[model samples]
Target: MDWPFSRRGLFQGAAVATGLAMASRGTAAPFDRLRQKNHPGWVIGHLTGAQAVAETLLAEGTGCVFGIPGAQENELWDELKARNVHYQLVTHEYSAACMADGYARATGTTGVLCVVPGPGVTNALTGLGEALLDSIPVVAIVGDVGNGEKARPFQVHSLNQVDLLKPVCKAVYSVCDVKQIPNAIRQAFQAATCGEPGPTAVVIPYNLLIEMADFRCPPLAEAGVPFDDAAFAQAVALLGDKRLRVGVYAGLGCMDFSGSLTAVAELLQAPVATSVSGKGAISDCHPLGVGWGYGPHASEVAEIAFAREKLHPHKSGIDVLLAVGVKFSEVSTGYYGNPRPKHVIHVDVNANNLGKAMPADVCVHADVGLFLGKLLTCGDTLRRPTDGHLLAKIRQAKADHEAKLKAIPAAKCGVDPLALVAALRRGLPEDAMLFTDVTASEHLAAESFRVTQPRTYFNPVDNQSMGWSIPAALGAQQAACGRTVAAMIGDGCFLMSAMELSTAAREGLPVKVFVLDDHAYHYMQMLQKAAYKRTTATELGRIDYRAFAQAVGVAYQEILVQDHLDAGIRSAVCHTGPVLVRVLTDYGDRKIRWIEAVRDRYAKELTPAQKARFASRIGYRTLSLKPEKSD
Candidate 1:
């Protein structure tokens, strides 16, 4: 579609359609004229406290505030509910933050979240970090005690709130002046969504929310424009080198700039891949499209295939890596094992991450979607796809992985990871939104499943936090009305937010949760098995997941093998309410020896500096393990 806010169309429409007809005879400031002629007797409401801030927040399009409501935030919650803004009561503050983060990631807007001061805020740090790293805009409105003895005691109880978040947020402001609430809301929105979007925090005093006052919202024009074009153009040229066999990697940012990415990719015809977080950024079936590669598991295959000749359809081979709206974390580049063919071009809204790990050959700091639009104009030409011979090699490399997946055998209690993923892929409804929690199961699903659309596949990749899938799916299901939301989580991930099933049941959200019951942190267990040659605390006693779901008043069933998966999913979907399908699987011995050999060959003999660099890579911490080997 047309750019959401086309400057030319906006300028033309304003000038031609309403310029003369709406113009005043004499020159006067628009705000001044509005305050006098059109807005006569329009008294500006003075919000005295926190409840008033909630009222103003409600006025500004926030439908719900996700949080673990407590004594400190009760007044604000009461007022928010009174204003008809729903409260997404969650099990933990982090899960609540994650729910909002997931919603914002999918919707490209500031997700509103509320939390009590101290413990509550601290609990949400993980989610906040995830949102920051992924460039997902979310507004964290925390209720802090006012400047008094209680505030000092609060400080002692809490890690310095703003200090704790400084590294992970766009900005943090304490709301003191009652009148500043509206501006604070606007600033929080701007901070969360501006160039290199991320979460922002606005601390409001706990006692102030109950204070009475009138609230007035600022006009839309006064909300400040997002980005500047001149600055954006400079950023676009950073990756505009013609000699560079540019591999355009996109993420969630491309979903917002859909046409811009298509325009730019069509012009360059470069091989494109989407990060898992940006799954729907481009059509996965397209010739130019390469699948998600942001972790060691797949990155090893991608690195080898990309480095060798004629791997992808665009065989030109990535002489220059141009990542747009994509976070180039260590995982994004295979723990830095994926050697750059030439220059690496990194474009993002966050300046902090521009050159953090895999420093870009050319770093362009600007709004991802905006810069993408400008890049389309800057590079306008349809070029041929790169080296053709490489395509066959990539196919062979991927086929090798597929063969390994097929060899995995099912265990008595725990199912094969590949079989579980295949079952979910085939069993779920066509339009279902699939969400994978952090575990070996997610890696299995990521490798085997094909994501047809972007937002339909959800995972907290930037932070890779555990326990995010179920709550995130709940939030997404609320956003996707009648459509199905299938959350594939591990046993641990389910425990983290399983209690929130009460909230799901209360809200009547129709989401199907497929709990991959491995009975431990499978990812960690895999690593331990690979490195330490055994397992310890990684294992846990079995709990009846069916009883747990029934206790929460939702439907539940057990699926022990691939044959039973389809029926279990169909039953869950037919229930018209929340359903939890627990799929029991063994830690079946299915080792990915090929991957281990690849990494061991290059990584085992690395120099100290190279090793240190590798350690600092994203997702590298978990590189000690390889998949189990059935053969």
Candidate 2:
């Protein structure tokens, strides 16, 4: 074959083959990738900006990209297709951000989302904020208007996307040149995953994605967990004191180190309570594991387990709270409802967060896993004999918690709200990915629903973003390899993202969405009724759920009473396609412990004049209102 060509022609053909080989290196395996340490420069052929993003993403081990296509980044979509990079076209930009977040939560990797600027960026803000506050890693690739020589005064879909993304992202990189695309995207992933994980955005102008450049940027080393040796020593001094009884309060940062966390808890003979986002960090079945929030406003089990000596004579309450990777946020703390311990050892990756929420006697700037590992390495000095009495007390509190849930009588109006949580807990699989919305039941789920595995349960805990679970479940379904992905959506929150069920149907993502149909924003009503002695602007319009389900092309199931609870959940979870299960919910006479505790704490903070104003208003409402309760 070679003999047929001239010497010059043979050399030319070899050069052409070499160029093709270089260009095709986009999909190279990890071993074949160039390393920055090796100083490999421009060994690959020139590539378009879109190709740079696609190749960089593949190199970084990101499996799928989630977002809708628009005018600004059509070329990028084409490149993604060419590279066989997986991408999901969500119904809305908001869902794109949320789905990416869901993917991140479900898979424990950096999730990617792509969208055009302005409205696309604005629509995704809430979801990004949720990821930011909840410490989930998500990478967003956004398209901006033309810059450089292609700069134009009036461009479509133009806005300050970089600034809009900043508050919600750990870092926002705006790429101006095609050469910077790969580095920026890689850096974006790094930013999202490093230290305190959060959303990170890469804003690339549309003009640059089509430009050609020789991309030689290799993947950077993933950042290691930060540690402060001096602070760690200080923290250990507090934790190692045998006289001080300890309780472990974990957060999302401890999700990856659940085994270590559990080990630390057992070694100290301590009770473990998690933040809202840290629900599944320790198995709820663990003897020492109490539920979310060790405070008056949180799980009753946690509250009792952490109560002072007066409450439990057999064992004194937590004298020292070893709060690891958790911030005592306002919502989690119920207006700082967490009782001040005799000693507080607060440790987190970010130094700025230490002692901000509640006062920390010793603040340690260290990684959750690293710190837990160090504690275990301290040998017999850090170990405490297992206290059988403490275990018995925790068991009793847990029993009481379960008994309380079971004793709640079925609602006379429709389905009992508490029953809904109980049924899902009973019906769902052990490994199911459960995503809950910002409803009153979120607190209930945090309390009554048991989570046994890390990353298996999620809620928009910090930002309290409504309607988050629907699309999030669908996104989890995409990343989930046959595990059940379900969402418990509030009646009010459902209206915000109900349309996303159609996305599930379109993509054949079998997400079981349970709509808690109360026909009102009962969470809001509970607050208003307590404060003002009445409710206003809390009622929600009801939709014909069966018809809506059919219109959305998903299987429909209705749980009208207690009889339908388990059967309905079973049917929906077993369905091979998307299913919308509507539970006719009545939150009648059920108390939200969180709201009650939060209310009491908030009232305690008010001034005398402020208290009188509230009291007078309530008194006037009681006297002037009609005999019948008014909306």
TM-score of each: 0.80, 0.93
- Using lDDT as the measure, the top candidate is 2
- What range of 10 consecutive residues in model 2 has the weakest lDDT sum? 36-45
lDDT of 2 by residue, 1-631 (tens): 3467689988999999987875665344354454433544222346778878887787778788999888899989988998889998888899999999999999889889999998999999999999999889999999998899759887887788898999999999999788988788878888888888999999999988877766567567768778889888887777788888999899888999999999999999999999988888899999999999988788889988888767554476888999999988878887788888888999999888999988988889988888999999985778899888889889999998888767768789788888889889999998999999989999888888999999999988889889999988888898996899999989899988889999899999999999889888988899988898878888777699999999989999888987788888988888899999889888888888899999998898999999999999888887884752645
Off by over 4 Å in 1: 1-48, 148-161, 164-168, 213-244, 294-296, 299-305, 310-316, 378-382, 385-414, 592-631
**Residue-level lDDT tens digits of model 1 in 18-117:** 6454223212345544643454322234334654565556555675678977776776776676557776888788878888886776556678789888
Q: For model 2, give the RMSD to the true fold.
A: 5.1
| Model 1 TM-score, 2 decimals | 0.80
Best by TM-score: 2
